[model samples]
Each structure stands twice: as structure tokens, then as C-alpha cells.
Target: MSDVGDRNGGNDLVRFEGVTKRFDVAKPALDAITGAVRGGEITGLVGPDGAGKTTLIRLMTGLMLPESGTVQVLGFDTRKDPAAIQAGIGYMPQRFGLYEDLSVQENLDLYADLRGLPRHERAATFDELLAFTDLKRFTSRLAGKLSGGMKQKLGLACALLKKPKLLLLDEPGVGVDPISRRDLWKMVENLTEEGIGVVWSTAYLEEAEACDRVFLLSEGKLLFSGEPKDLTARAAGRVFRVSGIPGRRRQMLTKLLDEDGVVDGVIQGDAIRLVTVKDRETRFSAAGDAEVTAAEPRFEDAFIDMLGGGPGGRSRLAETQRSFTVEGEKPVIEARALTKRFGDFTAADNITFDIPRGQIFGLLGPNGAGKSTTFKMLCGLLKPTNGEGRIAGFDLRRDTAEARNRLGYMAQKFSLYGDLSVSQNLQFFAGVYGLHGAHKRERVDLMTSIFDFRSRQSMSAKVLPLGLKQRLALACAVMHEPEVLFLDEPTSGVDPITRREFWTHINGLVEKGVTVLVTTHFMDEAEYCDRISLIYRGRSIALGSPDELKARVANAENPDPTMEDAFIALIQASEEERMAA
Candidate 1:
């Protein structure tokens, strides 16, 4: 490992001077931004989906040029010497282009060929990357067959094939689990120590907090540029923890968020973590029999505040939602020994769970862990090879149409027609869900108003901003207002404020007695669920409330455990048990 700075003859790898980029939109993708990335340091590009993080990275890679100012990478101007800039940097996009049909080794070799590595250097480079990514054992495995985490590691290895001076990773942790995210961070940190400058763009604030320096952008403008602590200090005294009745945390959170002085509130463990408006002393009376205590602020708290705080009022979408009524006292959703197999491979193994009405039940698992398979079976999208999946007491296998009619599903990826307008998409989904005539038009209008899509209703769904797209997808899912709602990674890459707004709507729906079944990679969002089932290797490994799950991993060394900690611990324990058995 040689010092990248020494080879480049400079510490500053990338520098922007009043850079501006536009893409025929109302706003510039990046507007007059100025920042610098130094060797041996991690520079974090933090922002919401349309916040220009990706645009900035593209400028560094010379894939796109700035409209006005200049972007210099490794002493070469992006506009003048893009080839030199590109040759001096390693870049990985959000969706790393890995050939699904190729094996892990084949993908690595392909990237090596593309990078033009010498024949003598090929063996050493491949060996180092395989060991670094811990992909040696999976060398012969098809890239498509690897888990989400493994795929990310393989992508990183490909990005490093040329061993450039600067590395730019754009949202590398998007779908990766906590353990794998940690591993990716470790890999990046190791590169920094070797004097390779790194730019990490992510919506996850926790990762931003760990960066040596961060440039927080919003709507193509730089909100702040400094150490993460400088930003965290902005929300210092305004943060509080409100603990109330054990089972009433969600209700209390809803009320607390509506308070005049409160800026944001979220469920954290058994309490509601709140951020109040700065300089306001408005007292809160919503937490009955609860204690209010000052709490430490984190990067997310500051990030939300900087973005004008979260949507603090009740969800308008929930207000117009019709209350769903169940006929009998049976569970709203039931999965009894549900199993799905493809030939000899079992994707889901006898998964079982029950959800009563008005509950948010979370189905959590790492990628390729069979949770998705089980969810599809329950949604009537897949036929179960064994056992039953029932909704409102109707068997999914026997009464597929009836079971599907009772549920509204939002897939992980935006499934709406991109070419259609917002209004068209709404009408289409409403029709698909059995809405007709006046009711369909009324529901479409209501969703437009509720989601604040009045001015953008005629805009193409593909061209809308990421947050708006998310809102449209959500509105379409609930247009018919089914008894059960399914959200799969609904807020995957959106910013913190958008996520808060989305959850506010979900909480409102649950309050109206709508049953929700959600699957997410975000551990914090798992706190919103009344109960959770963690699956690993196609088996249910743990089931409990957030606090109960955290308790399973608590010990003297770590008295308090976060949901992520519990998730990683439970999965490790399960793997160890299997090995021993």
C-alpha cells in the first residue's frame, strides 16, 4: 500500500470552485458549490434524494461537467482533462453494474480487463481484493446468487481494481444490512489510512456522523460544511426523550408531534425522542404518566432540523382514509407454516406469524434471507409450497383474489408506470383496486390534495423528484384503502424528512385500525412496529417487540442495545447455533 498523496504529489485530491450543474429542471442539480476532498480523509456528501450528492460525485468522476464553475480532480480540470481525472479515480454508482450471469471471479476479472491492468499485476490485485472483500469462498458463485451484502462487497472490489488515488462511493449502503454496512465502512476507512481520498454519499445520517468532514446539501444548496459535531451541536438543548405508557408510545408520539413547540418526534425503543423548536419553551401535556428528560442529539436530529424539521402535524392521508372493519375476531393476517421452495432450494422454511387488526407487524431480514419470499406468499403474489397464508381469515392459496382484494401492496421498487402523470397513475391504481366512476375521481383528487401533488399532478412520474415519486407511490397504494397495507422498503433512499413524513402517514393509518405488514432494512423504522419477526437462512430466528428483541442481546458490557445491534447479534447467534448443531 503506497501513499496515494505521495504518488499524486498533492494532498488535495478533488476541489470544487463555485461549481454549478443543471439538467433542464427548475433548479440546478448542484448550484455554485465549493468543497475539497483531501487525501487520507473521508468527505461525506449528505443530503436527501434530490440534494445533488450524486451530481457532485459525477462531476468528480468527469462523467458530467459543471455548467458554470470548475471541478478539479487530481490537479486535472474535469472540463479540460476528464480522461486524466477519470484515470486517477475509482467510482462506484448506486447500482453497481455487475453481470448477473458471471461468477464473482469472472466479474472481478472483467473489471480488471476494463481497467487495463497488466497480466503480471492481475494475480496480485485479484488476490488482494478477494481477501479484502472476504469473497474468496464465493469466487465460483454467480454474482446474482450472492446476498445483497456480498454483492456490494464484490462491487467495491471491482471499483478498486485500478487502485486509483481517489475513491468515490455513492450510497453504497443503500440496501446493505447493518453488519455489511459496517464492513464496507471498515474497508473505506482502511483506504483512507493509506492516503486515498474518499467521498461517501449516503442518506443515512449515522454514516455521515462518522466522516472526517461533511458537506450537507439540500435542494442543490450547501446547508453546512464542516465536522459532523458542528451540525449536531445545532440541535443540542432542543432534544428530549418522552417515556409514557408501554403500549401507547405511538399514540403519544402522534400527539407530541402536533404540539406547537415540537419540531420532530420518533419512536425510539419504549420512548418518543423529540426535537423542539429552537428558543421555544412550550410545555408538552400529551405524555400522560410519562417522564420527560433531556436527551443527547445525533446527526439525524440536526439534519432534520436543518431541513426545516419534519412534517409535524397529523397525516392528512390518514384523515381521509376509511376505517377498515374486520368481520370476525380472528387474526387480521396469519402465516401458518408457510414455506416456498424452488426445486431443492428453500426460500422460506415454515415461517409462521399472526397479526391482529390495527397493528404494524414488521418482517425483518437481510437480503436473500427469505423474508421477501414469505411476504410475497402472504400477499398472494407467490403460491406457497406448504402451509397457509391468510388475510382477514381468507386463505391466500384458496381465495387468492379475495385475499389480494383485502390488501394494498407497495413494492420495494416504484412499480407505477413512469411515463404516466401523477393523476393517471392514481386513476390506474384506483381502477385496479376496483374503484369506479365518481368514487375513483374523488379518490384521485383526494390523494392529490393529501400528498400535496396539486401543481405536479400532470407532471410525468419519471421526471418527478425522488420524494415526490415516493409520495405518489404511497398515495397509489392506499387509493382503495384496503384493510391491510403492505410497505416494502418504502423509504429506502429518501432523506430523513421524507421518511418522517412517510411514517407519519403510516402511523395515522394504523391509528385508524388499518393493519400493516412492512419489511425494511432500516432498524430504526422497525421501532414503529408493534412486533417484529426476524428471519435468517429461511427460518424465523427471533420474534418480539423492539425492546424485547434488544433485551435478548443485552449484557454487562453493553447494557443498552439498539435495534441494529440486536439484529446483528441475533443473526450471529443463529449462525453459531447452526454450526454447532
Candidate 2:
């Protein structure tokens, strides 16, 4: 039995043979899974939330046992020598714990002691980790005060305290700023080069693309496993971009989806992106107003195609004929010198910005740069210490209630009631938005149909998949169909397919004159915004369209820069300016 687990002894770091796990009255979390995680390479377990990603990780770490078959870690049976396996592996769970009360150095010291490292080795390890994580200057700062990205780095440093053979990261980039995410990935790659085995589990397919090998999972079953390019080849020559969509985008989208061989279609900018069945032959014309051209298939395009295509009939949540009515010529949202202070510590400093009606405006910044503070002030959730803002011509300070009524808000955290069923949550939100009688019924029906929540509406919102929960939150927020919507990090942790669909719906709303003020850590998603305000140290440093901002930071070395490159350059420039001042 022991040697049976050693089937791939040469390179396999972890192995599972027909392993299965199930919770009471639930489907198997890992259904007879068989796989090998190789040494000295990053193996990405890519799947949507509730697809048993964490369960598989736990099984490998000996944190959980399979009902049948075997799990081997470092040549040890997880069911027998669990502690020995744990001692030799560094597993960073989805929630990496950091002592909030401890200072940066103190936290490192604590982890060092917990890992039982030699006293002589502690100092050198701490120094190396601190320099690598870029936390040398923040040694005296409390962990509680660190930004989300900083905390993630600190967690990683602690995880590396003992230099274990394998490092497991579960969704490390969730809610993290783009730069920090890139830095973290670089660190992971560096570790791989050192002959360390790394297993990364993520819902974001982009992150999976970085791994040497990927195992795509769905409902606890392995769908595809091999090189990333092998997966990309699944939908090759079937992806396309249709631009010059003149008008009636909703109709055009629906028309494309309904067309034969068209598996999925989404509105992107003034174009509609569509995916067709690779072998199916069909040419589509959206009212003869759009031009279609074949585009290269990305990893996500293949993933969606593998999933039997996108949600066809129930792809939207907003009403078909919905149109937001702008109140006056002035922008729907205006913030003049908006400032918020926690005592002498300025959370948001004198931030001034204007949001025009019917535009998808983005508020982007590093974590702890006070993007949330600015959102709260603008949404009437927090009072500005000095400056004032107005929503739909209503003063945020004076007419807070009326201002809130004119806009929809989906918080960064999924803030809906956990124990409530999906239908109940939607119904409650409709009532909160003043829907009643037939109006409430009509809106509830639309929410159920658009988000495809009808089948599982009776299930608790807590139990739904992360993507479905996000859909529910968006549905609840827009049940009233307000003139403006404010979303903070709305697409964080969402899968690429769902994120694309979500943005497609947002684009449709913007076309109908519904203004949106949103924030996201995904730079590619930032490209969808009409204009963006780049915040740093609570100040609006740069504000422009994605292209304009990209051009602002472009150099001879980087002629055609991405939004991420532009963002990093601008933020670095801002830091330099602050230091010189």
C-alpha cells in the first residue's frame, strides 16, 4: 500500500489515488480524484469557488482525510504520517493568519519561534524575508495597520520561515492590488527556481496561465490537466471580435447568442466579443451594423468553451428597456475637496473629482490608499471632515438619505444576509428600494430569470457559488434601477468568464445612460472604464481615460504600455514627487 502511493516517485511531490471526500448530505468534495503534483514546478488547481479546490489542498496537507483511496505527501501517507507531512510542507491556507497586534518584526519573530528555527538562523532568515517582501522600512508598524497587499506579503514571509519543500498558496491574489499580485507571482517563480514545489489554487484563470501545469476542476472532477497552451488550443480559431455596433446593443447581444454555432457573445467597448463552436460553420451579422473578425483564443475562452458555453438565455439582470434619466446638465456625481480624517491620520485627503452622467468611471488605487474612504464619502456612508460631495444634485451632508436613494451601492465585501435564501434576499432588497405590489413581483421575476437564480433561489445565499452570489448582490443593488451605481472591487475573486459577463451587463447599463462609479484591482478590467481617477495616499493623483493614462506613462522602452504598466509608473512617479516635496 505504501509503495502503491509511490507510483511517480521520481518527480511527483504529491499524489492522490482515487481519493474521495464528502460532507453530510452533500456531493463529494473530491470525487475519486487521481493526480500528481510535480516537484520544482507550480501546479495550478483552477476552478470556480465550491469546486473543491480548497478540499483538495487540505487533503494534500493532511488537514482532511479522504473516505476512500490514498493521499501521499512527500512519500508519506496523509492518513498515517500527517504530522510528519505537515512538518515538511509549508501550507498557506486561503486565510493566511497574521497577528494584528504585533509589529512587523515581532510578527516575523513569532513565526520564527513557532517554526522552531535555530536561534542562529532566525536573524538571517528574518533579514532575507524582510528584504524580499519589501517590508524593511515597515518593521516597526503594527500588522493591523498594513494594507491588504502588505499583509499578504507578510503572510508569505512567515510561510517561508522554515524553507519547507512545498509551498501551497490558495487564492493569494484575491483583493490584492495588481502590482503586489505581480510581485507575489515573481516571488513564487523565484521559489520554483530554487527547486521548491508550489501548488496554487485560484479562480482567476489569468493567474493559472502563469503556472507550468494546470488542472482545471469543476464540481470536484478533473476536466483538463496539462500545459496551459494545450488548454488554450481547445477553442482555437473560434473566437472573434465584432466592432462598430451602431445601436441596440442588448438586441445585438441577444441576437448573436441566438445565432447558430454562437456559444457566447458579450458587449466590449463599441464591439461585441463572440465565441463560436470550433467545427460549426456560421457567419453572423448583427443588424448589418457590425464587422466580425477572428481573434486568437485565450485560456479563458477555452475554459468557457469547455464548460459547454456561457449562460445563453439568462445572461443579464437589468431590464431590457431600462434607461436611466439624468436629472440636470451637471454630472450626476460631484465631489469637491472631499476629505476624511481619522483623528490626525488622513484616510482620504482633499480628494476632488467629478463623475459625468452615463459614464463608467473607475476609482483606482493601492489598498489602504483610501479608495473605500472616498467611496463612503461619495455614497453618503461617511461624512467628509471638510469637503463636500453631491449625488444627483443632492448634498451628501445635508440630504444623505435622498442622495442614497438616487444611487445603487454594492460594497467590496458581499454584505448580504448569509442565512437568507436568494429569493428572500432579492425580495428584501426590492422592498428596501420601495418596490411593491406588481412592481416588486416584476423586478423579482426579472432578477430570478436574468441571473438564473430561480432554480436555486431557495438555497441560502451563503451556500451559493461565489459567482452566483456576486450576481445576486448586483441584482439586489439594481432592483431599483437608480441613476447611479457605486461598486468597490466588484470583480475581485470572480472567474474570468463571470467577470466578462458582469462587465458586459455593466456596459449595457452605461449605454442606457446609467452612470457608474466603480473600483477594481484588475488592470485589464480598468480598461473597460471610460475615465479613471488614480488615487494615492488618499489623493487623486491622475485622472483620465485608460488610453490617455497609458499614454501619460509610456516611455521609449515601453511604447505601447498596458494599464498596469501605466499605473505602476504613475504611482512610482507620485512617490518620487512626495519624497522630493
What does candidate 1's lDDT look like per residue over 245-351, in tens digits? Answer: 55557788888888888988899867889998899995888877788999999989888888888887588888888887454668899999999999999999999
- For candidate 2, lDDT tens digit of each residue in 265-317? 65443456788998888778553757778877878778888877876633355
Q: List the candidates' TM-scores in order.
A: 0.96, 0.89
In model 2, the Cα lDDT at residue 504 comes to 68
TM-score between model 2 and native:
0.89
Q: Please report how far candidate 2 places residue 128 from its true position, in Å.
A: 2.1
TM-score of 1: 0.96
